[model samples]
Target: MFSDNREQLSRSSTFKLLLYFLACIGMIYTVFVHQVYLSSDTFHRKQLDRELSQETEIFTALAGIGNIDAIRTLIAEKQSIASPFTYHIQPISTQTASLSYPAALTGDQPYFELSDLKSGSSLLLDDDTILRIEINRDLLQKYREDLAPMMISGVALPVIVMIAGAVWFAVNIIQKLQRVNFAMNRVLCGEKNVKLAVSRNDDEFDILSIHLNFMIEQIEKKEASLKALTVGVAHDLRTPMARMKLRIESLLALTSNNQQQQELEACHDDLELLLGMFNGLLEIANLNSGKQLISKQRVDLTTVAQDAVDFLQPLAEEKQQQLILRQDAAHQLDGEPSLLFRAVINLIENAIKYTPEEGRIVVVIDAFGIVVIDNGEGISDLDKLQVCEPMYRADKSRSQSGSGLGLSLVDAVMKRHGGELVLRDNSPGLRARLYFN
Candidate 1:
């Protein structure tokens, strides 16, 4: 289940959109951090440089006035106040002759390492003395620590909120699409009354729903018209065909010549075929239109399969085929007894008609349905799908004698019972199953 769900999420457009959104957010955050780091470093460096430059200028001016004592006094004041600047004064007369300005300040060593001196400045005094000043690194460190939390919260809060909103939006869109998909599936399953609900919010989804409903309405009208036309034509032709059959039977009775009698018998058989085809067409149309209601009762599927097998056994034996039934127990379900019987009969009849001589046929009855398997010339994979359609004959079955309405009628009956007719390749033959819910 976990793997299935992960695969589904990987295929979902919403998940892909979410990943894209996160990637974009990450990129923006990275750029923001880069810019913030550069700006902060530049600002702190400039502040440090200004502090060192100002200190050096003050000491150099004091030296220019030849006031070494004043410089020493000012250094002492800075040391007393615990200033962050350190000063070093050295005379040109002797290389090592340097005054620490404030001896305690020189020993204080405010910086941890040479790198800690963020900015430094030096000036040569008129008295041949050098003045040097260095700014403390603690000021920049403190500033960074203070700004760190603000920068994090500034980006973190918005990112979290945007992600939440994106997820909600993606879920909402997916749910709406699912609704439309479900309705479309129902329509594909022959539920012409199914329609997508419109929220009337005038959004894109609402507009889509409205258009789909209109399209369904148009399809329902056209389908009803076509079904009515087919039913009407078949109904009209069946009556005339029955009259023709009666007249042909009378002529057969009146004929005395053997050749004419044989010809009349052939005409009678053609009429019977036509009548059967028309009847099938009308029955299918009625079932599709819901005009033929199914009265459901407790039905024994095993009995149904046995009856179908028994009824068609002679036909199978005529071809030297072996017809068998495999039923372990009584499988009962709620369905129309006559319709289920007819469906079983149609499947078994098709097997007998298509199987070659000396072939084997088996009708297996189970809890959910019955499977009719045959070891004959099987239908191709592509033909299996089209064979269930009315009047559709596979190339292999074209030479066989059938009206091609057997599977179509069985399919309609299965649908009327809220079941399905599934066709499979039985390796060397066809496996036709009528499943009941």
Candidate 2:
């Protein structure tokens, strides 16, 4: 559902690592809080101990009174002062200790009171009632409120420091990046000697700077070589071109016979093809140098394919071959219209040249895609690999039909737009599919 964001992630490694550490801290702090300060049963047990002691003293006071009725009256009167203390009247026994302390005392409120038999001279509860002591769930909450902040502070401070440290490191990296970017800008603005500072950490940024400098060095070498080549070739080819032009003009003037005229026309054609090849080479260089930017817009592949097929129909008919056209998704795209049309035309023309008079050419177009299929003998895999290489041709003579640079030019055009020419075997024919975005 998503593209690889590895490049972006790599750029923000420090920030990502810091966030990871912060998340771990938060989790550990949460677990600590839950364990240390949030336990209710422990609170209940402690509260029960306190209640038990207080109830023992109260029962001792009531035990000295021998009148059971009088003692019951006094206990009833004091019930309000002893909240959460319960008294249950039953046959009290040593075995009842298992039922134990306050039966309903929660963690917060411990249930504790007196009970026993008067016969033993011990107040059953006061004169013959049993008492139970226990703690309840409320004691836990009471303890939690008192200790929660202390526990959180103890845990969260370290975590907060760690998070802040991560953020600080990220900010440091960002500041370093800004400085590096300023240096790069100065270099781009003609300060050729400007270079990035090398960091000693041996991290990815250090590797990137080293590689970038190496690339700049290579580019400088290539640029020097290209300049020398262009100047040398211009000097060499200029003389030959001028001499050929003079010879062609002279031949036209020296004879008006049909035979001489045909020869001169052929000679001119050869020189013109040479000029075209050189011009094509220059265009390829322009593409490689990124001087030519493609206009990126939604282009209708169907419309472009149909137009190409129509342009080749007359040629196909002259060759006694049928040209079939099919198209889909007539949507527009971000592209150079003239360049795209020229590319399509070149493919169709190439197919026509290879196709026999009785053969068929099929042109297909789908939304944002195109394919030109032909019923001519297919190209072998080895030949297909080099088919788009400049000046490379499987058929050496080219039957005096094409300059042998057509596919190469087309490949260069599509590549500039981030597209490619896919050569596939179409059974008895060759299929040239151009995929574009």
Candidate 3:
């Protein structure tokens, strides 16, 4: 069966976060264990010293009394302690001995001792039983066995707590990130209004969610713009193209020579204007469509601007328009060389077309981007949206200057680079900025 059965088994962001927490917990656990071992070792050593101290006190007190029966009485009356130890007294003046030990020791009654515990267990004193009360180290062996479990529990409990705490924190953060992930996935599934349900905080994730949502909003705007372009392109392309065909046929039917010549010239102008409009539409369509792949490469913006200015000088001079190229900053961009040049040229051309004769037009690069400014009557804000539609002109009757496809081409080029071309009004003219990110 064609199924993604294991897909869900793959770790969620939650699981991954939990795993990371577990890893950190594991590291902390190792350190805790080391400290526990060190503590246990130190405690066990102190316990051994404690056993020897009690033995010394008891043995000394008995020797001071100097009576065999008194030593027996002391052993019988002494209370048992947490540390494992045994007391055995032997009269050494004669060759007689006695032994006693706790039930925890290993022997017939789980304990064993020699009459002279001094000689039976020699690990500690090394046969130095002369003129001193002697003791055995069987007590020390039992001490380790008694304290082992308590020491293990001390280290184990904290490890459990550390892991639990790590898991708790991991689960909380993972839940937040998962919400954002789902929101984005919903957007891809045609859910336009989906939003990351992030709580208000100044954390890095919160900042990321904000920026990501902002980007989604921008993408929504561009998608809407492209949808509107279809209707706009159809309307703009049909009108003048329809007019040219009608105007030409009628002019061809005229018989008077001078009148025919004048009519024919008008017809030629309309056809030329129609052709220019189609060419601009074609340029924009090719750029936006998947059909024409741009041969993109790194390009020096300085050289590109200079070339565009040089190429447009003659056209600018024809209309007594001055094309001023100003470089405020150097830009290195990546795109098809020809397309970039054409887009920039169209921008300059649009400015030249709208500005009055001998009016100033400036083309400059800046930190913001490349800008084309002109001292012409600027477009109103309401009409700016209509400007990028192929062959769209607000004042369609006045066809003395623009075929109205210049801005359309510029918009397409900018959109392809994940950038924008904004037509903002200068106080007395139009200011166009082309941003390349």
**Residue 361 in candidate 2 has what lDDT?**
90
Q: Which stretches of candidate 2 lie over 4 Å from their true place?
A: 1-243, 246-254, 293-298, 396-401
lDDT values, one for every candidate: 0.79, 0.69, 0.67
Report backbone clashes per prediction.
0, 35, 2
How much does candidate 3 score in TM-score?
0.42
In TM-score terms, candidate 2 sits at: 0.46
Superposition TM-score, candidate 1 onto the true structure: 0.79
In what order do the candidates fall by lDDT, top score first?
Answer: 1, 2, 3
Backbone clash pairs for candidate 3 read 98-115, 105-110
The C-alpha TM-scores of every prediction are 0.79, 0.46, 0.42
User: Considering TM-score, which of the candidate structures 1 and 3 is the better prediction for this target?
Assistant: 1
Query: Cα deviation in Å at residue 109, candidate 2?
Result: 92
Ten contiguous residues with the weakest lDDT in model 3: 122-131
Which candidate gets the maximum lDDT versus the true structure? 1
- For candidate 3, lDDT tens digit of each residue in 90-205? 33333323322323323222222222332223111112121233333565556556666666676677667766665566555656766888888888754676666555777888
lDDT of 2 by residue, 364-383 (tens): 87764788899887788888
Clashing pairs in 1: none
